[model samples]
Target chain A: MTVKELRETVKSLLTEGKVDLVIGWGKGTMPGTSTPVFIDTAEKADSLIFDSTCRNNLSVYFTKDRRALAKDDKKIGVLVKGCDSRSLVLNITEKQIDREKVTIIGVPCNGVVDMKKVVGKVDGKEILEFTDDSKKVTVKGREFELTFPLDEVISDSCLTCVRRDAVEYDLFIGEAREPGSDENAYAEVEEFEKLDSEERWERMKQEYSACIRCYACRNVCPSCYCNVCFVDQNDPQWIGKSPEITDTMIFHIIRNLHVAGRCVECGACERACPMDIKLLLLNRKVAKEVRDRFGSITGTGLENKPAMADFKEDENQDFIMG
Target chain B: MIRIEKERIDEFIRALMETWSVYAPARDGKNTLFAPVEDPAGIDHGIFNTDKSPKEIFFPHSEVLFEFEGGEIKKVERDARPIAVWGLRGCDARSLRLLDKVFGSAWQKPDNDMFEDPYWKEKYDDSIIFGTACNEPRSTCFCNWFGAGPHDGAGMDVKVVDTGEAFILDPVSEKGKKYIGSLKGWAEATKKDVTKMKAAAKEADKAMGEVFGMDGIQEKMADLFLKPVWNDIGAKCVNCGACAFICSTCHCFDVQDEGKKGKKGKRIRIWDTCMFPIFTMEASGHNPRDMSKDRLRQRFMHKFSYFINNYDEHLCTGCGRCVIVCPVNLDIREVVREVMACEA
Candidate 1:
């Protein structure tokens, strides 16, 4: 199996002292989930697995625990999906992590399943097991078996992903699979943009109201690694602490703007949210706008400078009243 | 005891709404949540439990306490109409009683009137809890581990059990008996109907076996403050507050004043979690629980050891919402097992 091959590679890396810790995905507590596991010894490498349920972007650990690992003069290895590798590139460009002190083990993915959609399908039945094959996903419950099309249950970002292979990796497992859907990646945002100003504002308001201020979206994103978030600052409270409608709106709007040109569209924020808010749509919307204005795509390779960090001599400023 | 035919639920809810504003589990798209309903037809009663807890009906996520203008402060008026909460399970109903210990008695606390919170009292004191017995508990449910079961009636005014075709309303409190007795056109429950409810509840209890052994857990965790088990348990935690927010009994809050300069302000109480870095931050820029490991230690210690010292009851109701909604899949049941294995 491919998981065994991946485990053997990680074991050799740990045994050869190439890296001190290997961060990967492990069997989760639920049927259709995977948890991030940190393994420091070769013996624990077997606990790692890569599957459709391995949805977490392990690159978030680069912002955390990387400093301590570097202080000890040890390299750390991280597993990355096609989308997760983009955030790692962003982290490298932002200088949060030294590229020399880390190893990236990328894995080509065939679109992870959106757990909310699966759970919604099996509404009242107790799910006993779940298996994801290429074309079909079977969810076996206590008294029933349900098979759903794989494309229908995948995360929305995965549906239109053009990058199926890693942008940067020392070693990659499995061959790149075909893109699930050929639709335009920005089709949803374009449809949203066609709405009137009132409709757009109302849609944003409804999305923000469902927020519980849990900060899961902020904490889970690899790009959002600020020491003190804007919401937590009390010196001059920028946003209200309460989950009031206006406060929620301002928090989300500012958060999305902060990661405007930097977001990698990994859909980690959307996946991490317990409220099931469609947060990636906003990030994708901002990414589209940034590309339209700057003629650049974020985190494609190491040579490309970030759109926000660089400027052209004759930049177009027609929208800015120049 | 009164028997309500399954078909008469809408009529009963319509009658109940005449006196009290009724809140029940209703379908909101694919998710089920406790929402205010004018008509009972909107209620989704076939589900085992709602995705969100019923605690929000009384203790809202955010609420205004008072308004200040110039030099004067005015307290927010309490809702005059009473509330009837339907579809509360055993764990959720018991969570209310657990919350009452902290917010219930104000007259006899260390500080008399200043610390007394009237907001929780106004909504919770007059509210009636109609707890439904779980006939088919979900796989994530663990209410049985806390010395409660699918049909335990520790804190409910009225205990309801589904008999497949009818609902047997067993009044466990004086308020429940008075309300059910005064209602017209409901048939009295027979002995045969009572037996059916008991048999169904027993089957449910058996289905959800004990996931974690609760015996001696408090003592096992009492003095292991400096042990390495905490590090192992806290390592995988992403420090997201989804566990605390979805929890039925987590009641931490932060009071803040929102206003403009030379403008009116509103003082509101917002739901806060101990998992956040700023929760224990001192005014002098020093944080005692500075690391994620420290914050994770405090969460388990407070639930198992400190709360047992103060309240003599564990704070967790074992609804398992946290287990299900965790982004990184950190299971508290595993935390309990790890704590139980710790050596003194």
Candidate 2:
């Protein structure tokens, strides 16, 4: 849907007093990026936009420290892509956010551009101008101008995303398309599994060694809503604060487990990572396990509990019994 | 005036590596960062700024201050060779100088050596910094706001200008002059080369466009400490350390002792940020900065007001690494403008 329609929808929400604030994407200071904008007044609604550069999952605003934004029983209107909508549903099921307090304005998604991938395509030259159509994305720098197919530069999570439209939404802006095929959904996980244990460990070590331990991935994640993250606890100090490979690995592994089955594969964590670490590989692998063992997909419905949260008599017990 | 051909730059770096532990901007996976360069060919000169600042060279994200076992404490030491950093931008170079006031020298307590950090002094004091001129400053760069520009040579031993074909290295410090005198295969910079460097500097300075008026920002920030604008300014902030971790002048660290079974332990300092709620959390479980806005305000206040009051300058160098890395796009430039325009 056009940004005009999105703004119009939000303006009415604010003017009609349906919501106190609308959380959406606004033009970023830099090219090929969009910032999360909070529109409290109808006039501010004009700042809202929806496009490939709208990478942040706005549902994070409703949780943890940011929960103060929705204080005084102020209702919030959040624009959500397919993955974002799933995160919202998970928040509702986890009882972190009230379903009644939020108006989910779902937008049909074409997938967000990974700026890292774009930079890679340009061989790390600074992109001065960026434009994208439905079919292709173009970037221009001083020395080079390059264009790539939209799919070529979209996030890897978006490539295997089964749902491009929200499963649950208060209002959807455009006609929802059929869910994409799940055939290659776990393709990366399968490839990861192909490696021997030693090779897998080496790969993981190499990837995670680049981590600077900024916790951008955790902070940006919608599912990681713990009031006091384990890493922050000083009494026992679960792990060392250093970015030593062991400590970093522990942090990532624990975070992955904490968000397992709850992560909607929004790619927000990967996008937020300043180090460009492949954070999604382990997350996607856990997601694959959840799907395979529990016969469940997270955030598909308000009624469905997370795979880890739910219990089933017929569920696979190979992990425990083997 | 010394000159090194663009093709022979790697050779010079290799030569420096023989005596000094060289760190330069190098490709680390998809990102470019200041890393130890064993292969000079791996150094990336194309980047306007490294993904992370050169601050980590002296003050690492995590550093072991000392290790202790069986009632004996041992200090951590580095290799005998001093640190040499290549491809530092003018902003980063100035940031190191600003940091030196805190780490290398105890500016607050000039007569005392107790306040000085030995780890920082050991690496930073004797280190040679090769500050490179920005041929094309990025849109986010705002060193000009702090009365610094792309060609600023405040903290450089040698100021380098990349004139497309060759590097015009102007020795700014005695160390740099002596080093250049000792190095071989370096030709004298001609008058044309000097003219080219000056033109490039002018173009880069102009490209920075306009400098924000930061004349009374310190006073403005102090006045606005209790204002409601912080709510609007910090609304989209996720309270992450991305900005602070990437920042060059953000030197706050937390010291922790890690031990295993009460046998052996090491005291280490890890990078910390005011953006995190736990950074201000007290042992009694009471947090002074309980809200995200409070934490967010602390960062800006520390950078703009507190540092300015103490050091007579803003802690920020306007390198724009924080501008690029903030996940939510809480642009510091916009926050600064908003602070300046606030009615407080």
Candidate 3:
């Protein structure tokens, strides 16, 4: 949907009282970035917009209290891209969110550009306008021209996505586009298998040494809505809270494994890593293993139990010594 | 059935040494560790179990999937080495068979979109194992709890029993038989040797064994998952996860990716534990097993119930490595007994 049309639709949804609040995108005071805003009144609904600049996954707030007053009810409306919509579907499959409680405004996307990359290239100029057809964006009247190629600028998640269309939604805004290519993501796993013991460990240590344990990745991820994280528990912390290499390693490992067969490929973890930690590799690795072992994928349908949820009688262990 | 004399084990070692990386119980300073044997001249055969199992020989504490430098990917190349663990206690050896249910039998797919592990393959493939029967197991051992004994031939490539100055070697598989036969220094054992070995195993089993209440331990463990005794028993845990780390069969792990500015990074899989607080912690500060009691429950249930549910076998090897290695004296034996006390 066009940005103008999206705003009117949100305004109508708010005025009709079909929803308690319409969660939409509002332009940041600085120009390009879109901050998630709850339009409770007609006046606030005018600020809603749909553009390449609206990149944050609004679904994250639905699981927690991002748009709640102490006394107000928390019914929410969200603008979802294809990938974001998949996350919503998976969350529902996981029972993290209820469909009747959410009003989804689906937005078809070729790909949304990463703001961090755009900011680095923008060189301090404020972004003014972004267009879908021209695939060009104007930053403070300076035209930065580009054609649509998802791999270079879009979130890494959209690069190998098999679905470019929203799986489920209440209101449709735009037409679905073709999916991007299936880049051979498993190539590195094969390469890593070649290393000797000492060399393999040395390299793994170097990679984990950069983690700061900020938890930004977890907070922003739509699926990570647990009441208590194991990392912070005191009485019987399965993993320690010291932020040591071992603790960090255990944190990522258990986190990924718990989500194994259920990670919807949101790419939020990768985006939130201030250290640029490739958390998705952990998720993708488990996802790959889950698919290989069980022949099932997540978010495709709500009926499927997560990989670890219910196992088959014949789960493979052929290579093990018997 | 084959037997090599205890005095002639050196010949067997010398023969097997040619084709495989022969690992035996060796002294590292004062603590016993498993390592590759360099000479048949120096070996210590006193211990029934090594302080740590031979898991490190296959699954190391850590391994790299790939490396990243200046935004370009460099995959870690595997070095070729065939592995053969000597003096593998049946409890430790049977654990490998259990490990195969998760790692060996079936993993769903390729690991990552851009990764597949070769390190796991290299160690798992082209490997032969030599396990010894635990004639005189420790009071702490509970291998019988998992349908195995010191002489269980389920997972071992070959079985070894020490009878005074002689060592008996028996193959468990066709490959094992061929490999044992090809080892030139060893002699073909006679029926008399097998009879002597059986008697020795019986004497050892009668004297060294203790009643573990196995039929009750697994069911009791499942029933006692939420018991208060777990808190009293688990409260001593510092959550260092040293128990899981040193465990002969604990197989939980983590994966890492070292990416460049614009390219995909290397993905790695490393060891992990459920005892540490962060082991269940999510990115959003939510932990399902937020209480130590809950994590402790997971540790035992995974060993007794969940693992059995998954593999139709208890995850514990009953080798008691976790019991011995625990720094705070968190004995799994105490926990099991405590679990047995629970009504469920």
Q: What class would a CAPRI assessor give candidate 3's docking?
A: incorrect
- Model 3 segments more than 4 A misplaced: A1-322, B1-8, B69-74, B106-118, B183-185, B214-224, B258-267
Candidate 2 lDDT tens digits, B1-344: 79999999988998899889999988777677899998999888887798888899999999999999978899776787999999999999999999998887737574555477889989988899999989899888999999989998888999999998999999888988888888776799999999999999999988895888988898999999998899889888888899999999999999988885456999999999898888989989999999988999999999999999977889999899998999988899999999999988
**lDDT score of residue B188 within candidate 1:** 94
Q: Relative to the unseen true structure, what is the C-alpha lDDT of residue A181 in candidate 2, on a scale of 0 to 100? A: 66
DockQ of each: 0.64, 0.78, 0.01
Number of the top lDDT candidate:
2
Per residue, candidate 1 scores C-alpha lDDT tens digits across B243-317 of 888788888888888785546998888889999988998999999988787888888877887777777789888
Return the interface RMSD of the candidates, in order shown, one decimal each.
Answer: 1.6, 0.9, 21.6
Q: What lDDT would each prediction earn against the true structure? A: 0.82, 0.89, 0.66
Candidate 2 lDDT tens digits, A1-322 = 8878898999998889999988999999899999998899999988888889999999898887877555558899899989999998998898887888889999988989999899888876789899987679999988788888999999998988989888888998988776776667998799899999999999999999999888999999989988899999987678889989999999999999999999888899999988889999999999888888887788889999998889889889998999
Q: What are the per-candidate TM-scores when only chain A is compared? A: 0.94, 0.97, 0.81
Candidate 3 lDDT by residue in tens digits, B1-344: 56666676677677777777778988653245678889976667765577556787777656676777666778786646688888888887777776765666333355523232456666775788888887666655777666666567768888877766577778997778887767654567777777878887777566444656756466677667666777656543434465676688888877655344356656666677887566777767677977656777888889877876665777888887665444334567666676776676
Could you give me the TM-score of model 3 versus the true structure? 0.49
Judged by whole-model lDDT over C-alpha atoms, candidate 2 comes out at 0.89
Expressed as tens digits, the lDDT of each residue in A1-322 for candidate 3 is 6777777788788888877777666664334445566677878878887766566666776553332221245567777877688777777777677766788878766555565555446552334444443255544424564333334566666566676667677887767565543347555545665688787666666656555454656656776666656665544436543345887788877787777877877676776454445667557767777777787676756577676676677876554544
In terms of TM-score, how similar is model 1 to the real structure? 0.95
Error of 2 at B93 (Å): 0.8
Task: Give the per-residue lDDT digits (tens) of candidate 1, residues A68-160.
Answer: 553457788988888888888888888777788889988868788888888778875777798886677899987889998988888988887
Query: What's the lDDT for residue A66 in model 2?
Result: 75
Among these predictions, the greatest DockQ belongs to: 2
RMSD in angstroms, all models?
Answer: 2.4, 1.8, 24.6
